[model samples]
Target: MAENGTGVVEFVLMGFQLQAAQGMGLFIVFLACYVITLGGNLGMILLIQSNPRLHTPMYFFLGHLSFLDSCYSSVIVPQLLETLGTHKMIITFERCATQFFFFTLYASTECFLLAVMAYDRYMAVCNPLLYTMAMTPRMCLGLVATAYAGAMVNSVVRTGCTFSFSFCKSNHIDFFFCDLPSLLKLACSETSLREQVIFLLAFLVITTSTSVILVSYLFIIRAILKIRTASGKAKTFSTCASHMTAVALFFGTLVFIYLKGNMGKSLWEDKIVSVFYTVVIPMLNPIIYSMRNKEVKEALKKVLRRMKVS
Candidate 1:
């Protein structure tokens, strides 16, 4: 028998490892962030839905991205809020596994969605003549469906592998949520193969999606340079600005957290960085899109005015 217990019934989420007072402070801050994440993502979705002008493929993908961000934040942030309160954070095996599965699903889906958006932008900017015909509503729906399917497959594989192992080693999870990386660390069985698989999956998701985005940008930039007028080029570039900013923020944080090095040594640091993707980025998306996208801004204004009038 160990000092803690013989068998682990539930995993104790060592979320943030802050004092009670500090936890309370963070709770307030994260609560505000969660509210913003929900509001921003849902607002963007409704804004896109209501405005007939936003019926284009760009807004179509943007609306889906916002929905993913909202769901992603929802999966992690509410549990995080619970941990940030006065009580010790404990999640049952089943609930933790549920969290891990859905979070991965949403995260992976967002990655693929971003790549698809980049390709859409590339075609729109570089091959505007064929944009409407090629990116038809049917094709757009197929792409979104494909993204969800990929995420689901990956999530099922990961969660099944992760929970298959016994956790007699320790029940203390070092991160806020039951992420694959953190959970894998606690496994008593052979994790070398599982870790390799995870690393490969990470590489495939990050590299493949990032490659698409990069190549799409290359063609887009080339097309812009060929535009003779500076104003026309600026207008062309402006179309991609929000997505580029979003990609930079999302993938930048993702690369920093996963690829930098040694997650164990910087688990605490990684937790902080994790907050950006899980909480902050969702909130930032609508603001970024609304600010950089003139159409979205106008749509938002019109929506607000109608609400006020009512």
Candidate 2:
């Protein structure tokens, strides 16, 4: 194993302090969640790809969101499962860093991507006639590309700064995975500067993306209100319902954990919130979108009918 600054080659991940029965129960539950997350996300991607009717800017972004959720959950959930099953898990510094890097990358990208999706909704709802012109295939690709590029830069900096601290003390991380706040507790060096830097970057990302979502939704709501009939307003609002629900669930937990007042103080609360966002949300996204979306439902029905005939 490669020595990371302080000759600490590996770190022990303390999954959760629980009795045998509790651990076993959690293991089963989390395993089920992981399976569903993978299946649902992958199915969403395939369904979108298979249906030409779903080939719009909205579904294009949704397809990528499903992909990111799959990868984001995969990065942390497997290690989390191992830790929960074994009670403790050992990870080399290099491997831990790798996991952290990818986790951050996928997560940050999703934040920006969600905002992009919101903007797509705004255009579709508020400027239906111009949506096709505004959200062209090339423009959609560019937006997704920009999200990935920005996230990559953030991930590189966070990984470098976080792992740079010398870990001269205990190598045991109290949390299941290699997260920033949990890992920071083990640092022997001064973390104030790096903490500020990390926080600033996180703040910029969360706030900027949040601004976009809020502003887009503001316009969306206004446009919905101006519709001639209640049915018209409801129909237009329904299209944004799924995306709004997703944004609330995702950004709610994110804001609570990362951007709140008592950050890192409530480790237990943090862990619970972390589990929700990391484990449960991925499994829920495909369900939320497919169930609320008429187009996706119709496409799924068509697929099922074709399968039966064969």
Candidate 3:
């Protein structure tokens, strides 16, 4: 076994090296993505906060989702940008653990939050008479709280389990950040138990949330079909189209990366997949939600007008 602590203080991340010859170009691209991710999510939050008209259950959930996206992107992107710029991919053990913790937390929370949003839609469309009472402000607060709590618990479990294992090998993490599976691969001890635990957790979260969202949407579709007016159906569907797109993209990338065996994939391949969930999805979320929703546009205009007046 390698010396316990003497090998290296920091693990070097080998971020997208396939296009290594064009380091400057990749840096520029990621920089632009980071900027847009931050600005878009922040703008959404600001718009929702400033507009009284947006003070409803749907926008309430959206505001929190935007905030989570901002936090999620911020957790990974700045470090990634630095790696792209300097090609110095060193990350300290403590920093790596912290990054992995928050990344897992926010990612898991997003899964639950998306499910909650689907439930909100289901209630609004399928149980119109009881929608307000069903999705009360107190209920909304509780749902958001549960999402965060679940995320924190999952983060603690994953991070605690990963770090508890002894790391006597080389400290080089092949990817940009301390991803759970990559870090697991480095542990000196056997990871059968850890793998089992993680797989179970993944199954529980993904299957449970996906099942709920799917069932809710089934009811939503039935209710939409019952609407006699074509325009009414269109309007109702439009409200959820953005969310459905987001759910598809987010879960698709997640399953591809985590559910599949990471058998022969290169670190470069892993980083590319990581980009979809870590960076691209968050950047696209605000645009998808805002562009598709008339209320958000009106909120934006109102906020811009207020800013101009000030």
TM-score of each: 0.95, 0.96, 0.94
| Stretches of candidate 1 exceeding 4 Å from the true structure | 1-7
Candidate topping TM-score? 2
Off by over 4 Å in 3: 1-9, 18-21, 263-267, 306-310
lDDT per residue as tens, model 1, 1-310: 1223334568988888888888899999999999988988898999999999999999999999999999989999999998887565889888988998998899999999999999999999988899899999999999999989988988888787778776887888888998777777777878778777776787788898999999999999999999999999999999999999999999999988777645747676788889988989999999999999999988989988998999
lDDT of 3: 0.84
lDDT comparing candidate 1 with the true structure: 0.88
TM-score of 2: 0.96
Candidate 3 local lDDT, 1-310, one digit each (tens): 2234533346767766646668778778888998999899998888888778889999999989998999988899989888888777788877888888898888899999999999999998888899988999999999999999988988888887777776666676777778877777677777789878877787778877898899999999998999999999999999889989999999998888888876235756677778878989999999999889898888787777887999
- Pitting candidate 1 against candidate 2, the one with the higher TM-score is 2
On a 0 to 100 scale, what is the lDDT of residue 257 in model 1? 73
* Candidate 3 lDDT trough over 10 residues, lowest sum: 1-10
In model 2, the Cα lDDT at residue 272 comes to 94
Model 2 lDDT tens row, 12-46: 88877888899889999999999999999999999
lDDT of 2 at 262: 41
lDDT, ranked from best to worst = 2, 1, 3
Give candidates' CA RMSD values in order.
2.1, 1.6, 2.1
